[model samples]
Target chain A: MAIAQAPPRERARPARAPRTPYVLIAPAVIAMLAFLVYPMASVVYYSLQHYNVSKPWDNAFAGLDNFRTLLFDDPLFWQSLAFSAKWVVTEVALQLVFGLALALIVNETFIGRAVSRALVFSPWAVSGVLTTGIWVLLYNPTTGVSRYLADLGLMNYGAAPLANPDTVFWAAVLAELWRGVPFFAILLLADLQTVSRDLYEAASVDGASRLRRFLHITLPHLKDAIILSTLLRAVWEFNNVDLLYTLTGGGPAHQTTTLPLYVATTAAQSHNFGYGSALTTAAFLILTFFSIAYLRLSKFGAR
Target chain B: MMTTQTTGRTLDRPALPEPVRLPRRRHRRRSAQRVARWQIYVPLGLYLLFTLVPFYWMLVFAVRPRGSDSLLPWPITLENFDTVWNGLGFGIFFQNSLMVGVASLIATTVIALSGGYALARYNFRGRQLFMIAMLCTQFIPGAMMLIPLFEIFRTLGLVNTLWSLVIAETVFQLPLSLILISGFIRNIPMELEEAAWVDGCSRLRGFFAVVLPMLRPALVAVGSFAFIHSWNNFLFALMFVSEQEKFTVPVGLAYTLGEFSVDFGALAAGGVVAALPVVLVFAVIQRYLVQGMSAGAVKG
Candidate 1:
């Protein structure tokens, strides 16, 4: 049938094509499917059923009930959602402000500049577990630096940092910031390096004050970097339940139970895979929204 | 921006004419330079204090006996180190952590090496989609995958095994490794491969013979990142691997605290043991890590 209407161009196309590239990538594709895609898809399936851990094979289909329960019924779920949002907002905001300030200050030449850069960026090299562990020790109410300070009449040890529900959120925030600020600083500094010296020189000649120059030139140039950094950090902070897991175990009556921890606690510890998977889906949906929103905003801003 | 005006010198200081405005530019410039210098020093000094003091205290507390109530007291003891080795399984935990880290590193790097090369060199139809898939995978929190992964392992009869930890870590590192390696491959000139092909080598051979050697910096960077990530991973190791003998350092150290409740010195010692490998690894390849981090931002 093709012979009657076949074009000369179609006849010129080669019958056999190259195969090495796909062959080279076959193992990788298999591994990714086995490890990345399979498990994720399995979770989605798990979310649809109520399976008892003790009786692995026996299960009943729950359909969308788990999702409904999480969205409408779980008060702890909503609490954690609020807590997660607050955590990301406060953490990202403070990191940006302080990190930008740090970049500006460290951008100049001075005594101990190398030493300072080393010190500031050094924290970035420390692993997250170590950072969380250090803070956990520091936040220990009975035997920590807080107690020492209180003994010296500097503050009240009775006001426990991680135990008090009111301050526990801030405590988690501080721990996250301690680890994340270096990331913000380095990114901003890298961006700041691209700003031409001539702009600053021109601004100086025009009698623009330092603050005015910063407001006009520095901030505007930093806009893209700031947004990107904030987005990247927001995703990280959203998913980072490890810090809370190590330091507080999401305790003080679950005051520090951010979304990820809540999901994990529900799924693994409580052995409710259906509810846990639903919460996981919920968190992923929120992150997907942020990602889409960022993409749209960036495109809009670029235009 | 400062403008200068030349002034004539006079014997015994001539009377100045209304403090020449242009000449003041030089003095103002100097003042601005002074302020800039101060601005730079303050933050650096503060950062130094913030980053190093905690580490110093970590070291200090690890060495000091539990009897020393003074927070700032300085004289060190070897007793904690002794107890860490004898009373606790720091040695065993360290070995397990090393095993898990190396296993995950090798597994992820192998998968990423091929995947990254394919993404870099090939013009496949699903390439962009694959890249986007990787980005999405990165955003899926490890917690989200934990239970399902546990169930899968349970069904496969792989729970409480080090291989389970390795598999979980390798999955997490694969995306990051691929991104870094792809960027690295793009930076390398394709002419080297072309030249190799002209010598009658197949595309696969050309890649191995020519491209692989040049990827050293990226390999060091990605390998270190994968290793450190695997080393420091605690939650999975905690929840998935329940056997004491199978425990990685972080989980093992956490368990030490509970088992040896008031043995603060031993617990501190275990913590110290756990932290040393990463510090040494970071110190050895810090420059590569920085390059990796900046590259990550570009790709992230």
Candidate 2:
């Protein structure tokens, strides 16, 4: 009893060193805040006030007008925002599914798996400009693959995909998908390795069929990965300009013009600085919401 | 999906305990495997074929004669290459892209390695908040920073300079690099560094000698990523640089097409020339890129 009492007395005699992980992380924090937070704060400030590009220094405070215009008065803004919604959802969903399916097949220990993965990953190396160029060539009316198909009694009208306003959006989406799918394939393959083979073996032993096992085990296990992958890709898709710009330059009649292209056209090409900044500010908020909601949602289920 | 599964499993799995029937079951299983293999190959083969056709077309366009009307029926010639070399300033643009890509890679990699190392090794204050903030940087749309970034560069008298594009691309490169490297650093056990420290090496020396070598894979990953990001950068280059000589490949190629439309041959030639380095670099360092992307995405 005396020995135990003495041990307790010694243990309680000195307090543990205070845990301070923040001290180590200060540099990254400062770098981020300086580069990211400061810019974001400035964006908010600019959005609230009337910011003129030509007369940048002549700052005037215009409370909610910028937001009002962005929301209700601007049809292009709404159209572009709506396009982004459809754009990210359709692009990301199909890319993820196709990528996952491809990854699953390639992940198998089959002949030529390495070559297959390499071939698929080749597109990831090609620049946005090259991908767009190839697609544009394919969509050419006179001498492209589409025309060839039409000549062979396969396709109808032979109208180029990019030139058709109603179809231009899908054309842009496909171009983006060609670039985007490899991302999911690569990332999903990574997560797939982290899943232990023992789990599959055990499930199979329990007479769980592959389909049931995939749904209950693989899908559930891939939750964190799926959410993270989708979010990252969505953020990218929201900001992506090269694919859309190269494919259609916002399109036959602004059908494929995304928020980024719109902002670029407005500020740089059109020289409407104040309104452009206002529109850019709106785009930032929308993207910010996408990111924050994603983070919070993922964080909630991250156990 | 359900029918495919049912068929696959029925043709693949069987549960029985019999000695004399073993050879028959084994024979049956062998033929079933063959059938299953074909089924798997069909869809995958078609997808691969569909995906690669465009790249095939690109190659065709690149190598064919300049005046060839048929993009498909091609007598492959070096004439297109010659035209691209002579007419489009392909050599100059190629050199500029390499310079900018390498510079951004070096700058971003150095900063990320040091910063990521510091964050990983020390159990200090504000680490979580710092990481979250780093992530927050990626959250904001890249286009949002265009005007402000352009304004800053203009004020600093960096417009129309390669320095402006380099810095802008570097800024774009930094957050992702840091984030990716941080994950790799965290994988390295602290005991390794501690052992070096106990052997009389200073913290900085331990980092350089001990930690840096272990970070080779992550370095390769981040370097390749930085290279690609810089190479593909169009918006910043378009906004910042106005001089013809200062143009990077993407912006230069984009400009090949004016208001009326594109010049396909010249654009195709430029595209081919521009993509060559990318393909070469990828072929050499693809292992690292895959490793890095997978590693980065997992932690993220």
Candidate 3:
């Protein structure tokens, strides 16, 4: 068959190479399928069955029983869900504002700009568990910033921010913002460079103030990047459990427990696979719905 | 198109040049630009304090002699580094983390390159579906998949192995890497490859000769992301590998954070150890990050 074919046309892979794309995508698809899709399917499947590792004798198919318990009887689920919403909203909003401001500031060419950008953005590489470690050292009552503040006759002594319910939320927020803001800054600053300087020059020629030029030119141009980064960051904050797990451990009556954190504790500590899977499924649905609704409401990519 | 010049926000001065004083207009504008210098520095200085103090505190704790309460890192000692590295076994964890990070980087880059190429150049059946499915996978939480992944690893007899971390990290990192790389490949002109073919080169040869060089920034961004995420991954390493020797850096750091012996110096030392490579990698790759995002992400 090859002898009859044209030699020049058959050089690449012959006529049977039509499935090259499939072959190329095979490894990624296989890995994702084995790890991502398979586990997700199993999570749903396990959610319907009583699959606690410690209590094997009592195991049985649970159906909607776990869902029933979660919906009607589980106050922890609702509380964590509420906290998850609040956490995502607060973190996303604050990170965006501060990140945008920081990006604009650093985007302007000035003396010491390079060093400032490097210093301000350095925390991004630190790990979450390590972030918890650093913050724990700083949050310690006697040896931390509060101690120094007390020496200066500023803040009172013996104030444990992590232990107090009123202060833990802000403390965690501060630590996370230290890391999260840099992400938005990098993304937005990238987009900011692409903004045509001609627009700003034109606005200035039209006697527009700097604030007016920024409002009319910079912010509108950054819309898509803002929307996408915020959405991605929101999903990430919802799913990420490292900081909360190591920082507060969702303690002081689980005040900081997000839904994913709750699901992790349910699975890791209690070993209740059935209910944990149920909680996992619920969280997945909520994320999907929220993401779609958010994109729709924000009119992302609508121009 | 409205250009309302309100001086309210930039209210550094109350007096303005009279419209009749046309010659003073240039001077007024120059002064306005000059006076705005503090606008950038003042806030940036405050933020730099927010950013650097914690790191300084970490350094102080890591190196300061034990029981020294002074803010300065004077009379520094190597005791904490010695304790964590030799005594607490972070040395082993560091080697393990390096191995896992590099392995995951290689695996993710290779797989994502091929997959991204397919998505970039081909319009095959189910291509859109494949892309959508990959995006959807981002919503799946790593914590939620802990139980099933543990079971899978157990069946594979990979429990307490560094390969498990490598595999898990590569799997989670592939989707985003693929998306980003595909976007990058789309930006490269298709004519380059076609011209290579016209010059008697095969597709593979053309890719190696033409496409690969232009893909350097994208490769750096993707590779660095893979390494950093794999290095920083905590929950999977915490869940999948339980043996002390097999533990990665984050797991080691988590132990230092636990309710056991609270050695601040050792913990901070271990943190410094964990933060070193990624911070270096970030420093090298961050310049490409902005360029990569502008080309691949913002437009898309």
**Candidate whose TM-score is highest:** 3
Query: Which candidate order results from sorting by TM-score in descending order?
Result: 3, 2, 1
Candidate 2: which docking quality band? acceptable
Least well predicted 10-residue stretch by lDDT in candidate 2 chain A: A1-10
Q: Give per-residue CA lDDT, model 1, range B147-234, as digits (tens).
A: 8788778888889999888888888888768877877776667777777878999777988899899887678878887898889888
What do the candidate models score in CA lDDT, each in turn? 0.73, 0.72, 0.87
Residue pairs with colliding backbones in model 1 are none
- Note the residue pairs that clash in candidate 2: A20-B124, A20-B125, A21-B124, A21-B125, A22-B124, A22-B125, A22-B126, A22-B127, A23-B124, A23-B125
lDDT of each residue in A1-303, candidate 3, tens digit only: 111112122223334567988999999999999999999999999999998999999799998999999999999999999999999999999999999999999887678987788778888888899899889889988768998899899988998999999999999999999999999998899889898866766677677777887798998899888998998999999999999999999877999999999999999999999999999999999999999898899998777
Better of 1 and 2 by TM-score: 2
Q: Candidate 2's residue-wise lDDT over A1-303, tens digit each?
A: 010011111221113433322433344455555555666676667677777766767668888888788888889998888888888899999999988987777666668877787777667777677778778877888647877777779987568777777788788778777777888887788777677766765665476767877898777777777887898898888887777877787867778778877988887876555677678777766787877787686772455
The C-alpha stretches of model 3 lying farther than 4 A from their native spots are A1-16, B1-35
- What would the per-residue lDDT of candidate 2 be over residues B233-269, giving only the tens digit for each residue? 8888888888888888888777765436666666667
Q: Provide the lDDT at B147 for model 1.
A: 80
The 10-residue segment of model 1 chain A with minimum total lDDT is A1-10
